[model samples]
Target: MLIGIIAISFSSIFIKWSAAPVSVQGMYRLLFTSLLMLPFARPYTGAAAALRARDWLLLLFSGCMLALHFLLWMGSLSYTSVASSTMIMALEPVFIMLGAYIFYKEKTAAAAMLGMAVAIGGVVLIGWGDIGISPDNLKGDLLSIGGTAAVAVHLLVGQKLVIRMPSYLYSLIVFVAAAVVFAVYNLVMGISFFHYPSKEWGIFVLLAVVPTVFGHILFNWLLQYVSATTVSMNILGEPVGASILAFLLLGEQLKVLQWAGGLLVMLGLGVYLYTGRKKTAQSETALPSAS
Candidate 1:
């Protein structure tokens, strides 16, 4: 989980580092990730074939959501500060929690809810210190919100899908579908997928291998062990990581309010995780002992 978090922390940095079109970069990232998964996922082809038609449809739907998520979030980066965009997108957990409640009847602990509120407040401070509220940035901000909703849906569907399939097979299916979605989007936009320079291609590949493969793959694998809300909540720290990276690599400045907000975000995350652990331990203790 720690490694996955660190890998994903570099996602915005990589997106910022490249000059490629948003859809193209997203296309190759998922394209390469799907290709890499083929070797392992190929062995699970029989398992995939055994899946019901509805499951396949759900996987395709999740893939489309994932594609839109990358499209909107990466596109937003073109106009907004990384801190603003990433922090806004971090509201994904709230959306995920709401969706979980509506769709799956899942409920969260009071502590978790309080932690979410505190973390959201911190995000507001970070945004207050960073965003200018101009029309262009507002566009990016709205895009981020849309992206958050898209990803929340993806994660909600994935929580259902991953339980019945291994993470690798599920990811392979989703990535392939997402790759196709992006390919179509690129075609519609008249963007040439093969036109980028080698450096940009390298960045795209790095984006695939690092964040897409290692980061999200780990996330999918962990879904079997935790709730989707927990998985999404874990990502709230991403804004802080991305902001710090933006400061070092892109020369973005973090004002005083940003620093304070980052600290509060971390503190809230700590409380969330600690409370989660306590709950898990209590549930285990209440279970009948094995003979």
Candidate 2:
């Protein structure tokens, strides 16, 4: 999880370093990631073939959501401060938990809802502050929130499918599907495919190998071993790490209101996770003891 958070922290820095179009960065990151996963996923071909028709549909849907997430998120980095963009992502687990409760009928905690409200208040503070500064800042904040929602949808579907398929196969299908979406978007928008310089290509590959492969893919694999609560809490490191990295590397700094809003976002989500973890612990204790 340490490696995963560090890798993900670099995601914004890489996008900030890039010269390519936002969607291109997303396209090639997933494109190269799919290539890297091909060999491992190939071994699971038999498992893939046996999946039901509905499974294929689910994969496509997940891919679309993942593609939207990357596009919106990378685009946000283009227009907003890294602190604001990454802090808004703190809502991801909240959205995912809410989606599960609404769709899968999963049990949830009222504390989680209260925490989400507080966290959202934090986002509203950021948005309100940004509105007075520039339209683009607000634009970036909205984009980040949209990206968060899109990814929650992707992971919600992914959590269900990863339990059924090998991690490599599931990841490959979703990554490739996302890459295809990027390809179509770029083509329709007349974004160049092979026109980028080697430096940009290198950045794309780094994005693929580091964050996509090591960060997000690693989390996907870990879901098989640990509770999602563990993963969610550990991922809170991204906003802090990314903000610090942005300061050190990109010289990006947040103002007073932004800092206060970021704090509320973290505190609210921390309460949400702590409440959920406590509930999970009690549920496990009462279930049974192994003989």
Candidate 3:
């Protein structure tokens, strides 16, 4: 899981390094990943057929959400600092919590509510420090948030379907669907898919293998062993890892206020995870002893 976090942490950096358009970068990344998994995934064709109609629907929706996520997130890096873009991705859990409450009637504890408030406060601080009135930065921040929301939806929908298929197989299907979506999008936009330089193609392959294949699939596999809250908490490390890499590789630096804001975001996420887990543990412990 830690390795997964580190791999995904490099995602934004690779996107920053690529010169291709957002849709093009996304398209090739998914294309390569799906192609690589095609053989392994072939064996699962029978299993996929066993999936119910609702499961297939969720899978398609999850794929579409992920495609939109990459499109918005990769696009955001063009207009804002990597620190801001990565930090904003941390908002995914908050969205997930609210979504569970609305859709599943899952009750949130008071501590969880408080943590949400703190998390939002951290978001405001980060936005203030990062955007400060620049329309361009604001645009980037909003795009990142949009990406975060899409990812939350992807995860929420995926939780139901992951049980129906193996991790790699499910990932292959999602990536293939995402690739198709991005390909259609690129075609509609008249974007050239094969015109990127060799260097960009290498970066696309790295993006596909490292983050998409290794990183995300590891998380999917880990879901069987750990709670989703635990996974989400560990994912908070991505912003930290991405920030450090951006500093070392890209010579990017966060202002003091920006650092403070990022700290608050991480801190708030920590509180959120802690409170939510505590609530879950309590509920589980309170179950009837007859079980």
Candidate 4:
């Protein structure tokens, strides 16, 4: 989990470092990620044959959503501060919770609600420091919010599909579909897909393999050993990790209020997890006997 978090934390930095157009970078990242997974996932084999038509459709949609998430998120970096964008992106869990409850019929306990409220409060605090009403900043903020919502939908859809297929195979199909969409977008925009420098190319490959592939694999693996609520709580670490990296490598700084906001977000997530565990335990004990 720690490895996955650290790898994901670098995504914003890497995207910022890339010199290519946002669409091009988004497409290639998924393209490289899909290729890397192909050897291991082997979607061409019997595994691919086993997937239902509905699964295929869902995977395609999920891929498109993922691509949009990246495109919007990466583009936002051009118009807004990393702190604001990343902090807004950190609201993925909130959207996830909402989607899970609405679509999956997942119930939220009282503690979870309280935690969400606190986390949202924290987000407002962080935004208060760096947020501007200027047109560019507003556009960036809107894009970031949209990206976060897209990811929540991705995860919600992923959870459903993953139940019927291996995570690797599911990821492979989704990435391939995403790559196709991104390629089309690049072509329409007249962006050069194959003209990046070697250093940028290296970062692109690393981004795909390290975070998209390995990090996702590790996260799914942990699901076998830990609860989803616990996993969601751990994801709150991404913003903190990204903020630290931005400070050290990108020379980004946060005000005292922003730091406080980060802490509140973490605390809220902690409350959600702790309360979720208690609720799960209670439900298990309440189950009727088989007779």
Best by lDDT: 1
Clash tally, candidates in order: 0, 0, 0, 0
268-291 per-residue lDDT for model 2 (tens digits): 768876787788788789888742
**Cα lDDT of model 4 by residue, 1-291, tens digit:** 778878887888887777788888778788888777677765446877988888888999988898888888888988887778877887777787777777878777777889978876776676577778999999999999898888777777777877777767777788888889999988888889788789888888878877776666666555544544456556666777777788788988878887888789778877876787788777778786532
Q: Of the candidates shown, which would achieve the greatest TM-score relative to the real structure?
A: 1
Q: Write the per-residue lDDT of candidate 1 for residues 1-291, one digit (tens) a residue.
A: 777877888999999999999999999999999888787666788888889999999999999999999999999999999999989987888899899999999988999889988887787777777787799998999999999999999999999998888878888889999999999988988899797788998999999999888788899888888888888877888888888989999999998898888888888877777788789888888786742
lDDT of each: 0.89, 0.81, 0.78, 0.77
Q: Which residue runs of candidate 1 sit more than 4 Å off their true CA positions? A: 289-291
lDDT of 2: 0.81
Of 2 and 4, the candidate ranking higher by lDDT: 2
Give candidate 3's error at residue 10 in angstroms: 0.9
- Compute the lDDT of residue 6 as modeled in candidate 4: 83
Winner of 1 and 2 under TM-score: 1
Candidate 1 lDDT for residue 35: 83
Selected candidate, larger lDDT, 3 vs 4: 3
lDDT of 3 by residue, 3-111 (tens): 9878998999999998899899998898998888887767788898888888777788889999999999899999998878877887676787677667757566677
Clashing residue pairs for model 1: none
